[model samples]
Target: MDLLIDSFVSAILLVVSLDAEMIAIVGVSIKVSLTSTLFASIIGIPLGFAIAFGDAPGKRWMITILNTLLALPTVVIGLFVYTFISRRGVFGPFDLLYTQRAIIIGQLILIIPVVTAFTISAISRIDERYRKTAMTLGADRIQTAWVVFREARFGIGAAVIAAFGRVISEVGISMMLGGNIRGFTRTMTTAMALEYDKGSFTLAIALGLVLLSFSFGMNMLFHFFQGRSRL
Candidate 1:
């Protein structure tokens, strides 16, 4: 127990001293996660809105598929992307494997379903009366969609925040696609895993602290939106 206590103290001191390596890893993690989340939001939000509001025959099946994908394992996505980026694959000429971009791609795949699923739920929760009222005012389909979207903005914000939270903490895609290259593609989660494997707690604890703080901040933002929607 003494050793554990010493490690915790040392970790705190390292964090306070602003360890460069730790900071870099955290920065990479944030960059990759945020980039991927942004792309996911761009694609997922519109796709989800279309699925929920469009008149396609397979809308129910699509939503069901997306909901199932929400629980997809990170490693599965990593493997799936790895195959496509590998030398034998069609897109392998780009040499994207083991790069930060590769990790971003993997993370994007991991979060798209999450964003879409949450978006559907959020949009669905908006009162149907809003859509009815817009239609009664002689609004076109596009205009009604716009009105409904505006009313559900808070909920959509929550969906995005939730997607960010998921991507930030994921390690499988980061490690597998990024190769966990130190000072390059390494991220907080991957760094934590590497540090723990090396029996070092300083970097791991520091990254853990950062991840926890980020998750808490996202939760607070989500809660803020929920509160605003209630008003």
Candidate 2:
């Protein structure tokens, strides 16, 4: 019990002091996560809009596939990407394995479904009148989309935020694809895992605290956007 208390105390101090190593780990995490989330948003948002508004055959099956993907494990994604990026694979010539870029690529795949599903939900909930009214006003396709986008902005924001949160907290992809290279690809989650294996708890605890803070912030932002969307 006393050891646990001491560990927490030391972890708090390390976080309060903004330990340089911790900052670097966190920086890598934020960089890769934000980059992945940005790419996912770009691809997923439009794809979602298309799926939600366009009449396509087997749409139910498509949504089912996407929803299933939402539960796809990070490690499975890691192994899948590794096969393509590792030596002797199709794209292995680029030598992207064990790099920050590799982590971003994996995280991108991980969150695209999240953004797409959330976007579809958001776009679906808007009253049908918005689209009809836009068309009635002589708005062209692009303009109509803009109108719908404006109305669904908050919900979309929450989706992107949720995607960011997903990548920031993930570990399996970072470990398998990034190799957890210190000062480079080591993210908060990977670093915590390493610290745990090394029997060191302070840094791990500090990183956990930082991760929890990010999660809390994301949830608050998500709810804030959701609330605004209701109005």
Candidate 3:
């Protein structure tokens, strides 16, 4: 109990003082997570709209695959990406293994399905009349998509936020793909794992507090968007 208290107090000090190392880890995490989320949203948003509206063959199977992928383990994604990026692999010549970019790639794979599946669910919930009404008004395919897009904006925002939250909290991909190299690919989750293994409680606790704070903020935003979606 005393040890925990001491570590907690020291963690608060580290956070309040803006410890350089902590900030660096946090920065790397934020950068990787945001980059992955941005790209995933760009791709997933359009892809989800297509799946939701299109009647192409095998569309149902594609959605099933994406829904299954939402639960894919991060380690599996890490190892799968590693196979291609590691030396002696097909893309080995590119030297992507153990880099921040590598981490981003793994995270992007991990969350793209999340964003897409959530987006599909969101679009599915909209009234069928919205699409009919848009078409009745002579809205072209693109314009009709925009109408549904605007109506589903809140749910889609929640999807984006959920993607961000997923990647930021994940450790396996960051550790396996990034190699947790300090001053470069190290991230909050990786740093905390390293600190805990070293029995250095202060820094671990500090990062945990920071992580939890962000999680709280994310949950609040998620609920806000969810409420807005219902309206």
lDDT, candidate 3, 1-231, per-residue tens: 999999999999999999999999999999999999999999998899889877879989999999899889999999999999999878899999999999999999999999999999889888889989999999999999899999999999999999999999999999999999998999999999999999999999999999999999999999999899999
lDDT (C-alpha, whole model) for all candidates: 0.89, 0.94, 0.94
Model 3 lDDT-worst window of ten: 47-56
For residue 45, model 3's alpha carbon misses the true position, in angstroms, by: 0.8
- Pull out the clashing pairs in model 2: none
* TM-score of model 3 (CA atoms): 0.98
Candidate 3 runs further than 4 Å off: none
**Better candidate by lDDT, 1 or 2:** 2
Report the Cα lDDT for candidate 3: 0.94
* Global local distance difference test of model 1: 0.89
Sorting all predicted structures by TM-score, with the top scorer first, yields 3, 2, 1
Q: What are the per-residue Cα lDDT tens digits for candidate 1 across 14-112?
A: 788889988898889888888999999999999888877777898899988998898889999999998999999777999999999999899888889
TM-score of model 1 (CA atoms) = 0.95
| lDDT tens digits, residue span 84-134, model 2 | 999977889998999999999999899999999999989988888999999
Worst 10-residue stretch by lDDT in candidate 2?
53-62
